[model samples]
Target: MAKTFAIVVGESSGDQLGAPLIKELKKRYPDAKFIGIGGEKMIAEGFESLFDMERLSVMGLFEVLSRLPELLKIRKTLKNHFLQNPPDVYIGIDAPDFNLPLARMLKAHGIKTMHYVCPSVWAWREKRVEKIKKSVDSMLCLLPFEVEFCQKHQLNATFVGHTLADKIPLEKQTLQAREKLKLNVDAPVLCMMPGSRQSEIKRMAPLFIQSVNKIAQSIENLFVLIPVSSEKREKQLQEYLVEASFKYQIIKQDSISALSAANVALITSGTAALEAMLCKTPMVVSYKANALTYKIISKMLTIDYVSLPNIIANREIIKELLQDDATEQNIVNAVLILMGKNEQLRQIELFTQMHRSLIAQADIQAVNAIDSLLLSK
Candidate 1:
C-alpha cells in the first residue's frame, strides 16, 4: 500500500516550507498520497488541501480571538477527518495556535504527529514547551538553537536548517535585480514590506506610507518598492498610498526581487526581515499590533529583539522600532543612517555571515526526521 501523509500549513511562509518538504517526500515515496491544508505552492507540489490556508493565517492575540470560531471549526473538521481515516503521519507546519491542540488530539488517538516549526517558546511563553512535549512526536526546527531547547525539554526534535538559506545565493545581485524590476541603478531604492497578512498591512501600511513621505523629503529621487502578498493586499496598500507624496511602485507577491533591488528597506518585523537579510538589504525593522495585543505581547516576550536578523545574531545588528516607537520620524531617521555606505557594508557583511550559518539541506533533513518517526511507530 502507498504511504499516506497529511500536512497542514497556515500561511505563505508555511506554504514555502511545506512545498519543498512535499517534493522531497514524494521523491522518497513516489506513490505517497498527501492531503491537508496548504496554499498555492503545496497545491502545485500535488498535495490535496482540505481547507483554504487563509483561514489560519491570522496573527496577534486580538486577531486570533476575532476569528476563533471559524478557526476552531476548521481545526475540528481536520481533527475528525484524521481520526476517522488516519494518515501514516500528520505534519503541522507552523501556526502553533491552531496546530498544537489538533496535534495533541491526534496524538491521543495514537496518530503520529510532527510540527514543522517550533513556536517562539524560547522568546516567550516558556510554559508552552511543556505543552509541546505532550503534542509533538517530533519537532523539525529551522534554527540550530532550537534543537538544544527541544531536547532539554525531552521533546524529539531535529535541526533541519532554513529553506531560505538553501534557496538564497551567497552573493545577491543588486544591479541585476534592479534591471529586472526596471528601476534606476543609481537611485536610492526603499523596499517597504508592510507584511504578508491583512491584519499586519492594516496596522502597518499607513505608518510605512507616512514614513516614506518623510524620508522622500530628505533623499531626492528616492524610489520606494512595496511588495504585496496578494491582489487584495495590493488594493489595500494602494488605498493607504493615496495620501503619500513620493515615487513608489507596488510589486505583486515578489518580495525577494523587491528586497534584492533595494538600497535600504523599512520592513515590518517577521519573515520579511529574514528575507531582507538573505538579500543583503540594510533594513529598519518595525511593527505595530492592535493596542491590546501589543500590551499582552509586551508582558510575555522574553527577548530583546523581534527581527530575525537580530534574534539569530543574538544582538542588535539592525534597529527595531516597535509599537509607539515605530513612528514616521524614527523610521525616516533609521533609513537615513542606513543610507551611509559604511553602515550598509557593515550590515551586508553580517548578513552574509548569518546566511552561511543557516545553509543546510533542509528538505532532506526534514524527510529523514519524519521517516525516523514513522519507522519507530
Candidate 2:
C-alpha cells in the first residue's frame, strides 16, 4: 500500500522549500502521492497543485482582510475535500494563516499534521504557541534558534536548517556572475529587489527607484539590476521603470544571479533579504504596509529587526527602514554607508558566519522528521 501526503505551500519561498522535500520524499516512497497548493517548482517535481498558490500569497493584515472572503472560500473547499478524503499526513509548508486552521481541523479528524517553517512566535503573537501546540503534530523549523524555542514550549520540533544555505555557496562567484549577466565587472552594481509579490512591488518599487536615483547622482557608473519574480511583476515593475532616469536592467525570475552579481542591494524585507545575506551582499532592507495594518501589527511585534540577517545575528547587522521611516533619503544614506569598503567587509564577514551556521542538509532532515511522525502513528 502507498502513502498519500497533502502539502500546502503559499508563496515562492515556501515553494522553494517544498520542491526539494517532495523530490526527496518521492525517492523514499516511490508510490507516494503529493497533492496540495504549490508553485512552479513543486509542480515540476510531480506534486499535484489543487489551487493556484498565488491566491494565498497575500501579506499585510489589511491585505489579508481584503481577500478574506475568497481566502475563506478556498480554506473551506480544502477542508471539505480533506474531510471527504484525508491523506496519511498533511504537511503545511508555511502560510500559517491558512495552513494552521486547515491543519487543526484535519488533525481533529485524526489525520497526522506536520508544519514546515514554524511561524514567528518568538517575534509576535506568543499566544500562537498554544494554538500551534494544538494544531501541529510535528513542527520542522529552519532556524537554529527556533529548535530551542520549540523545546522550551514542549512542542515536537526539528531544526532542518535552511534550504537556501544549502543551495548558496560559501564563496560566491561575483565576477563570473557579473560576466554571465553581461554586466561591467568593475562598475558598482545594485540589486533592487522590491519584492516577489505584486502588492509589494507596487508599494516599494517607486521608493527604491527614487533612492537609486539619489545614489546614481553620486556614483559615476552605477548599474542597477531588478530581479522580477514573475512576468506579471516584470510588467508591474516596467510601469514603475518608465519614470526612472537611471541605468537599470530587469532580470525575470533570477534573484540569485542578481544577488551574486550585486555589490550592494536595496531590498524589501523578506526572503530576498535572506538571499542577499547568503550571497554576502551588503544591503539596506525596507518595507511598507497599509497604514492601518502597520499601526496594528507594529504594536504586536516583540522583536526589533525585520531582516532575517539581523534577526539571526540578534543584532542590527543590516539597517531596516519600515513604513514612514523607509524614506528615499534614509535608503540613500544606508546604501551609501554600505558602499564604503570597511562596512561592506564587516557585513560580508558576518554573513559568512551566518551562512556557516545554517547549512544543515535540510531536505533529508525534514524527510527524516516527517518519517518519525509517520512511524509514531
Q: What RMSD, rounded to one decimal, does every model reach?
A: 1.3, 1.2
Candidate 1 local lDDT, 210-322, one digit each (tens): 88898899999999998876677788788889988999898876788999999999988888898999999999999988899889888998999999899999999999999
Would you list the clashing residue pairs of candidate 2? none
Instruction: Please report, as a residue range, the 10-residue window in candidate 1 with the lowest summed lDDT.
Output: 228-237
Report lDDT (Cα) of residue 110, candidate 2: 94
C-alpha lDDT of all candidate models, in order = 0.90, 0.91
- Give the per-residue lDDT digits (tens) of candidate 2, residues 1-377: 89989999988889888999999999999999999898888999999999999898899888888999999999999989888988989999989989999999999999999999989999999989999988999999989999899989999999999887898899866997898899999999999998888788888889999889999998889999998766777888999898787899988767889999999999988889889989999999999999998888889999988889999999998999999899999999999988998999899999999999999999999999989999995
Clashes of 2: 0
For model 1, the local distance difference test gives 0.90
Off by over 4 Å in 1: none
